[model samples]
Target chain A: MSQYELAVILGMTAVTFLIRYSFFALGDKVQFPPLVKRALRYVPVAVLTAIVVPMVLLPDGRQWQLDWRNAWLLGALVSAFIAWRFNHLLAAMGGGMAVFFLWRWLLA
Target chain B: MTTTYHPTRHGELLQGARDSLPMLAGAAPFGIIFGTLAGPSGLSLLGAMGMSLFVFAGSSQFIALTLLSGGAGLAVIVFTTFVVNLRHALYSATLLPHVAALGQRWRIPLAFWLTDETFAVVQHRYGAADASPLKHWYHLGSSLAMYGNWIVWTLVGVLLGRSFEGLDKLGLEFAMVATFTGIVVSLLKTRPMVAAAIAAGAVALLARDMPYKLGLLLAALAGVVVGVLLEGRNATEEGQA
Candidate 1:
């Protein structure tokens, strides 16, 4: 591997590992305040939504594609609805991807 | 569903792997796509596999490849990786109470293998109303499954990319969105949780232009604050009623 590539991989590895391991390393040494614990309860929902919303709404990461041509938004909506209704992971993904590919083909 | 039933560690481990099946399905395409694109994005074979093995976080690895392709500097790539993965810190903290009693050896590997899929499944397993002491084994099973799945698929994608063309543009990454949507939807058991999701989505849209993906962090904070405040209000109303 090139020097630059190695550096990039190593840097990413260190940073990602540290972030993931930080709290586990501290363990019971640091007790979170009750308020912090309450906040932590919402982290998964909040973070996942934050990541998913923009990806669906702005697939290009630069512009808002809210129209029908945006297969991502449509597929994600279908996925979310299926998940809410059936609460099945495989169903959500399968239904969503099917819609996404079918929508793209229709558009094309 | 008997109250007296206790699952052995081996059973828990296998159960964890079984529970991760859907997530593995969701992540398979993503890992393969990453493997296919890594080469075109200027990563050597060793570098790409090294990343899948060492970095092990799909989103950050994809982001790093994007930044590298864009000629971003080393520091920029690293900083963005750190910012994007800050969510894992929250995950680790959330699971810490369950794992705090384990030794460093267990904690270290568990932390290393803690991906989005594992966290989604393992956390639910931990939250289940069971007194099984083998829950950690469940976590281990889920982690190893995801880890092995990622490495193997990445290698497959690398080889497949060498033979095929245009696999990266197929929108397979949407699998991740679909999977995450399922996870978040299931987690929305309470009104506050639903409100937090809506709040986070709105704020993330508004703050999409923030540098270094800080918008994600800001959106998550906003959601957490809204959820906590709403929960507190609900508690107070209950007391008054």
Candidate 2:
């Protein structure tokens, strides 16, 4: 690997590890405000949506793929419905994949 | 009310492992895809394995892999992944008081092991009325189980990548999306929660063109701001009433 590539790897390893380790080490020393604490409750839902939305809406470029042929849109709906109806992550996953595959096959 | 069942450390650990199974299954395909993506992206065997072994954060690793392939600089790669993984600070803060009594032995390892999937299960686990000390073991159980799962699945992905060519095209990643959707919906027990998710999705979409995946962070911040403001407003309304 080149120096640049090696540096990127090592940098990632160091930075990510330190960030994950920080609050545990310094948590007691610092206390969060009630406002911040309340907001923290939304972190998971927010972060996950932030990650998942762009994939279904704009998988490729900077625009929404609001078409019927959008596999992600179709599969996400199937997955979201199954996920809600079953309230099971694994089942929702299975249902989503099943729909996604069928959708892809049908499109093909 | 917080002291109902006091499970022994062993039981908590075992329960922790069992509860993590659903998220584990959700993550399985993701791990495999990451492993497979590593090779064609010019990552060496050591690089792929070392990343999973060390960083252990999925989205950041995926981002790093993409940047690596694109010949992005180390600074950019590090900064981007750091922003992506910054949400862990929120996880850490949320978990702080629960694990406060545990010493460094528990704290250090659990900190390293924390992940979105593990936290999804663990935050609720920490709330079991009879939970306190046993919760630490439970944290260990869930985190370590996920740690092992990622490693094993990444290995499987690395191996499978060679033989399976069309896995990405197979739309298998939707499983993770589906799993996340389930987690998101389940957590939306309040109006602020609903607003938070909507704000996040909308902001993420709006900020999609932001460089270095800053859009993700912007979206998260937007959600938190909206949720917090709504929460404060509700508190004031209750006081007035």
Candidate 3:
């Protein structure tokens, strides 16, 4: 809406394009070293963890308080356990949804 | 070994559809949510669909939609979308070697269609002890299927948003978190991986309120650092053993 907001949005777009374009533009020219390659292997796992963990553990804030209102932690556990044992996506999702719904109902 | 069962383009499309079911499962809901919310944010169905078609990434689309509704400038929208979609650069880079030999014509389309699910499937097929070109077909098949699913679901959301009201506050937003949790849990398969995930998650929690989605970037950095540290320690222990 404001000029400042416009600047931020456009700036983000430029940065994103720059990041993506670098890969295509430089990928053929640049050779990644072995250490960098190995490190890249772990990036996804780490990034994903960082994204998921906080959402489950501290849904609202950094208070670190766990209560019935936030069913994310329980749902995550249920899903993880099911996925570990059964190795099925539908099953894990279903288990999580069921737990989350049940937890919400019981707590309510 | 790679030559056996070379799938025709049609066959690849069919297979891509079937293989994309898991991706579609999450994609459909997310796409719809994006659609439903975009309308309330002052975007038209055409605008929303156009965004989906062009951007093709859910989070970035949502960010763009929010910026648009809030009357943010085009520059801001583009910049935020770029930052949010930065991960795609990493994704494309990782997938480059596997798809390199496909030649320029096929390479462009294939690269364009590559999504997270496609990347995972393609990476697995590439790693398997097979040299078949049909593996590319598998990637193609799954990607096209996901592409269709995303378009269709986004359309549904647009239609729903146009006709129905009051669906936004029905709490469909939680599905996003649920989907992310599912993805993260499934991806964590090893002890060090799990530890790194926890560390990053903790960091994200601490940095949740940071402006401009810095939390995600910081969390990713923290996770990488923790994983590298753990890996180094493990290597040393193995050497000592």
Interface RMSD of each: 2.6, 3.3, 4.8
TM-score per candidate: 0.85, 0.82, 0.75
Model 3 lDDT tens row, A1-108: 344434444454445545544454443546677766655666666555655676677755465647657777787778777867775655676687678767767776
Model 3 misses residue B213 by how many Å? 2.9
User: Candidate 2 at residue B64, lDDT?
Assistant: 84
Residue B10, model 2: lDDT of 82
Better of 1 and 3 by lDDT: 1
lDDT of each: 0.86, 0.78, 0.64
Q: State model 2's lDDT.
A: 0.78
Compare the candidates by lDDT and give the number of the best one.
1
Query: With candidate 2 superimposed using the best TM-score fit, by how many Å does residue B48's alpha carbon deviate from the native?
Result: 2.3
Which candidate, 1 or 2, would have the higher TM-score against the true structure? 1
Candidate 1's residue-wise lDDT over B66-139, tens digit each?
A: 99898999999999899889878889998998999899999999999988778877776777677788899999
| Alpha-carbon deviation at B190 in model 3, angstroms | 4.6
Ranked by DockQ, the better of candidates 2 and 3 is 2
User: lDDT tens string, model 3, B1-241?
Assistant: 1123444756655655564555566577777788888778876667667666655667777877677777876666776676666666766676666665566565666666655556544554455454656667777777777777788989999888755544543333344345445555666666667777887778887888875567877777777677767877888999999
Tens-digit lDDT track for model 2 on B90-196?
78877887777667887888988888877776776665445356688878888889999999999999887767666556555565666676667667779998899
